[model samples]
Target: MTKNEWEQDLEQRELEKKAHNRGYRAGVKTEGEASKRVELLENVLLEFVGYDDKCLQTKPGLLKRKRADLVDQIIYQRQLMRELYNHLDDDVRLKLRTKVESHIWPVTHSED
Candidate 1:
């Protein structure tokens, strides 16, 4: 092949390399984000419900209730987080968490 043709082929290869690199980087980033999200969720669950390695060791009514409680806690926490997040400014929500410094309000309100 002529020198000009060779250079053109080299340039094309370089472009392909760069495109592949971008895609690879994006995939790595997506995988990493997913991993972190899952890890964080597990950690959060542990924090809220704690490690119950033996909770399911025995099958009865209480064990089932215990498992249900864990699910409820996760759903409750997610709901609280969602409500707090909804109140935040759009710009601040992404950069900061809604820190709960005050007492938690009752989930149900009673008529006076």
Candidate 2:
């Protein structure tokens, strides 16, 4: 490709990478909120059932279903973030240098 084309493509990729990072951050935030809600709900449910072990054997009901759904959402969000991270080039990942990425997949300096 010509220099101009290469530059334009790089710019576009940069924009996409930024957008992806923003979405990933939002997803993480949502996941945290959902986790908190799940914890609260679990505590409430346990208290409501008098902390009985038999409550765990009961059939899935409203509270249990809601908790399950939130857990599923959290898992799905994590999977999406993983997929997005995998799709990005190492150069783009380095350029973004998001805290989440830094913690999970630290990029080393490359001579390229």
Candidate 3:
């Protein structure tokens, strides 16, 4: 083979080898188990949120629930805004804006 052909073949083999290793690692991690799904989720969350084992142990339920609640609140606010834009009058919109800002601003701006 020419030098260019030989280099191309070598690069193709290296790419295939990397793909195979990734597939093998994924198979090992999964293993067709329900518990493995939960463990994988925890691992991902720990890495994403930078949380340590001690924090998870101390307030696991509270921490998870708070994260979920924040997500739900964001969804609800989006839906409410969409509805208000199409349906609500200025008076109703002003009242809702005032009420939501009063309840939300303090919690969101706290020192903690």
Candidate 4:
């Protein structure tokens, strides 16, 4: 084989190796699973808001519902983080929460 053909083959092999190591094969999440996840997130956020608003209430049903929502949210959030962290560098994953929170609501120091 010519030098150009040999170089192309080496580059192709390297690309394949990287793709295999990264688990980039198709069919990760099905459509139904994605939809269910979205529904769970919405329910969790709604329940959380309700819980925050009714902090004075002691209704058992509401409390149970809120607890269930929170559990689902935590599970889904952890799954998402795991999937994201798999593709991101360790440092970025480690600082993800801090960076997101700081960007959303930066702290303001007042002079006393």
The candidate that wins on TM-score is: 1
Query: Model 1, residue 21: what's the lDDT?
Result: 100
TM-score of 4: 0.28
**By lDDT: ranked, best first:** 2, 4, 3, 1
In model 3, the clashing pairs are none
The candidate that achieves the highest lDDT relative to the unseen native structure: 2
Model 2, span 25-59: residue lDDT tens? 99999999788677655645564446676664245
lDDT of 1 at 61: 37
Across 51-107, the per-residue lDDT of candidate 3 in tens digits comes to 867644345544664565545544655655586566988898887777777678867
Which has the higher TM-score value, candidate number 3 or candidate number 4? 3
The per-model lDDT (C-alpha) reads 0.64, 0.69, 0.65, 0.66
Worst 10 residues of 1 by lDDT: 103-112
lDDT of 4 by residue, 1-112 (tens): 9999999999999999988866644335566557657877765555545666554333664465556565777787676656766998778776885677666767631211
- Residue-by-residue lDDT tens digits, candidate 1, 1-112: 9999999999999999999999999999999867755754554556456567553223463355445455754676697678778998987875563222222333322221
Query: Which residue pairs clash in candidate 2?
Result: none
Superior by lDDT: candidate 2 or candidate 4 = 2
Give model 1 RMSD, 1 decimal: 14.0
Q: What is the lDDT of residue 9 in candidate 4?
A: 100
